[model samples]
Target: MNKRMVLILKHLLAVDDPVQSEHLAKLIQVTSRTIRSDIKELGEFLSKHGASIEPVRSRGYELKITNDRSFRTLLEQLFLSNEPHDPHSPDYRKLYLIRRLLLADNYVKLEDLADELYISKSTIQNDFKEVKLMLQTYGIAVDKRPNYGVRLSGDEVRMRFCMSEFIMNHSEKKQDEGLTSGSRIIHSEEMTLIRGVILEQIQNYGVMLSDVAFSNLTIHIAIACKRIREGNQVAMLSEDVKNFRDAEEFQAAQHIVGLIEKELQLTFPENEVAYIAMHLSGNKWFSGIEGQQAQDIGPERLLERRIYELGKEMLTEIDHDLNLNISLDSELLIGICLHLKPALNRVKYGMNIRNPMLDHIKTNYPLAFQAGVIGAKLLESKLNVNIPEAEMGYLAIHIGAAMERQHLNTRAKRCIVVCTSGVGSARLLHYKLKSKFGNRLEVAGTTEYYKLPHVPLHNIDFVVSTVPIPEKLSVPVVVVQTLLGGGDMDHIENLLAGERKYIFNYIREDLVFLRQNFRTKEEVISFLGKKMHASMLIRSSEGFIGLVLERENAAPTAYGNLVAIPHPIIPQSRCTVWAICTLKQPIDWAGKPVQFICLLSIDKNGDEPPSIMYKHLIEIVDHPEIVQQLLKCETYEEFARIILKHNLY
Candidate 1:
């Protein structure tokens, strides 16, 4: 592609309203034939890539791509990767004319089309027949209506494919011809007005008034003008165009009045003017952003607000570190806006949202640079929600970091030191814990024993208390029992893995469990009894149910990825709800697979479960390796070992 075709695609993408072929031809500086061919070419491009472009009645083509980071990324790269070029090679000229005639807004006069292409009317007719036949292969058909003339309808893809082949043949010639001719016909004022319309729409519509919508609208407006000049009694406006009027039907008529008075330099009767305005107003040809405004803040402001907020949220969620900050200047923001606008459009329209250029953002704004993993996950889970590629990339970074941190820590277990105040003995206790665990056990964050009342007294993988233990704050608090033998570090590694919660920005609703043989229902009660050790009735439909597991909704666990892990971060009851179900076949949870269901209940009033269990759902989903092992496990023992031995957060 070259500059002109790119421009054409841009225009086509921008159009929100349907337009006539005549309008497209005029706007692009091509004969009706050339305009039609371009549309065909565009459609073909969309399909070959597994994307879509649609045409509406009295409107032009609209693009439809799956919404996701990957697609958004693809579209941005496509536009930015290469420049536009000529569509028509030498051999495609014949098909090009056929495309124009077929796609023209109104009926094309056989004589007029033939005269323009320097071919006989019969040749034009024959070309139409071939095009029509091709349409059938794509499951589309040509429709002929009385008074309305010849038209094509049916499967959108077919029309697009046929159109693409035809456009590819002639786009080049049209581009050259368009450049020389378009410059002479289009005025600066017109371009200015068009640009104004686009700016306004972007503000008013937010993401809805997409780039494709704008491009198509521009073509339609230009074509509508041509019909009026050709004595076609086209619609024009009767009243003055206001910013926000309820009687919009008359706006098109008014705009037409403005166009003629300005472009054609003519005046019209009152009724004719009203009809024109009505037509323009009723259709999407007019600017969708007419009443909206965009802030004139420098690019730096836009970047700071959007990038900083996004970055801060990312770091806080993924890493406990809160001191980092990211900032960008106006120059960088301008580039982001220019490049990211297209990327955003693609994502909003269900295309890939990821942009290769995003890598450059780090180089340009170094402070803001964090791995794209978290940012990408945040984008996919909260913004795009379509592509998984970015999210996957993010996961790799997270897991790598986790492994790195683990490697650096002298293979120590975690020990929570508790004390009152005075700072002297507390400091000594902390030093001792660190000295003893130094490569053997890690010292988690420190807190006062008294403050423990307000905080959830859980997640204490191991605790060393200088003072008498309170009734609460449980994790195996070792009363410093003589402060001898250092302390058993065998279980510290497991606690380290379990205590941290790795919140995944992306969560899918689908969960699949892969295991062999169902655990006997009786096992449910046994397991729950061992875990909870509380007297509980076996609530069941027919036979004894597994140990009664209870679930509490102290807080919500709904994250992204269409997934929600609901469990009491802390078990409050001795009775646990143990239930099992073996799907005859796999069922999709959200969009994944589901095989096993685990419900846990704890007696917060008594013994406390490990803090690692607090982040049961989040940690499991975040670690792909763990999820894989769990999915492939064949037995309950194996699954239990995997769950118990490995850390979730």
Candidate 2:
């Protein structure tokens, strides 16, 4: 169906309860009558796909699936359809306008564009406001004439880069399926031919590229070919071209261009060949040496010493802030050094490469992503160049891999069993633990309650005691019966999994503010900052709020699900803590709707890594049901109960 109908269907599928038409209208920014009409049409469409929209008497609509298999297939087909986006949708209309202008050969009249989209001229003019803002990011501007309408004007290189972003790339398409945009700048056959030629040449020349890099290079070449035929060519400085010509990729670019010249019957300028070589250099992959030691691999030997030094600095900064303990990881060191070499080239040349795994990395590995942000800040400070979110995402992948490696190398949870009855009872509990947890738990022998203080607790993760130990000890004490019940086992399991039994350790009742009326992100942050300052949690409200805003400016913390976990750029608190606020109405947080704000302040001098805390926050961020429950709570008690019930999942 249309884009709005698809959105309605997706929303209905997300929630179990029936949704009111007013809510749907507000969500889609349409009238209630229009939502009803769309729902009727959607119902007819779904009837044939083994699903239907049922109208509840008091409530609005709910999706009902008749056949699970057929409904799943219909869903797959619906999302995969190549139909043009609905023009009535504002987002789609904006995209349509951008693509039209980018591909236009001459200045087309605004009235003509309005007529083409079946929209009023006033509406098209309104859409141009946002379109202009978007184009401005790429250093492009609309040159509007007196009566001739507007045309895209920018540096030729920047124009092509913008074209690559909005025109050449489709989120749904596979990496190998190159240049499947609606612009049709190059025919499918020509794209295939160009890709095959590049693949053959790169393989022949012993140059390695990831699938994403390979596809991107193909798109760039295709764009260059199309632009050259249209009498537009990229101009580079002579010294820059001379430098690129010295690289190994320059030879590969020459061979690849030579073959494509015969196939396409078009001659590329020497500057264009150098441009291709630049892309090749930026996309190069070093392989088959991941397991080598840092000294043996010698990052300085593989790349410029400056890049290796910067990589070390990045790791040191991340370790200092997040305490990830990965600074000494040899594999991670090599990976970062190798990545920085090409990354620096791409950034210097203003090449914007897409990271396909960015969303997945953000959702699944937030701590690592935070570490990536720290690394990005270091790079920006040292190199005096801005690193984009996409580049930070690539850095996160390396840090994430290293984090996982560190986790794997950690030993199993070690604890001693303390029984009051006798040695036999403690032995029974120890064997039970060994049998239930297997290698995940290491039972470090038995101990009497009276002799617990003599037992070396420093080496233990925690102590499983049968009798009550009133006095506090160095290690955590889990009081259990001589015979462990399911509940007791679950408590032990949580400890083993590095999860806190109570989420209140981080989420304090005094820090929670419910049903606040916040109009903007700044106001919400200001409110939380004041509350934190008043509570003596922070030294300066302005400094804390500024840091949080700085991080938001770098990259938004709103991860959808009506949730946002905003935090300072660096650790600013004495201990890791959260100041939470639930808004009475959802406000726009960097374009995402957010009603739940969790202001995270990481411990500046924490000995333990914050990965587990981030893991729990991600669970809350990813679950819409939890956010919904949290938004409904009017009191701190209600909120805490809900969080404790979920127990940080």
Candidate whose lDDT is highest:
2
TM-score quality measure for candidate 2: 0.87
Query: What's the CA error at residue 618 for candidate 1, in Å?
Result: 9.7
Error of 1 at 326 (Å): 28
Instruction: Give the C-alpha miss distance for residue 325 in model 2, angstroms.
Output: 1.0
**Residue-level lDDT tens digits of model 1 in 1-649:** 4444454565555444444555444344557777677767766665655555677675455556654565566566555433223433322433444455434655655566567656676776776677666656545666766655566665332343344334322224442342324322134466456546545533543323345344433433433344344444422223332322344434434554555456455455454444333323322322222211212444434443664355445444434211212122223223323333333333332222222433223222211222233344455556745423332332233333333443464255556667665577677767766665466565675667776566554544567666677575556665653243434333333454443333321111122233424333234334433333323322232222221221111112222221223333222343323222222223333333333334334333423322223345445534433444555576556656776677332
Lowest-scoring 10 consecutive residues by lDDT in candidate 2?
171-180
Error (Å) of candidate 2 at residue 624 is 3.0
Q: What is the lDDT of residue 380 in candidate 1?
A: 59
TM-score of each: 0.31, 0.87
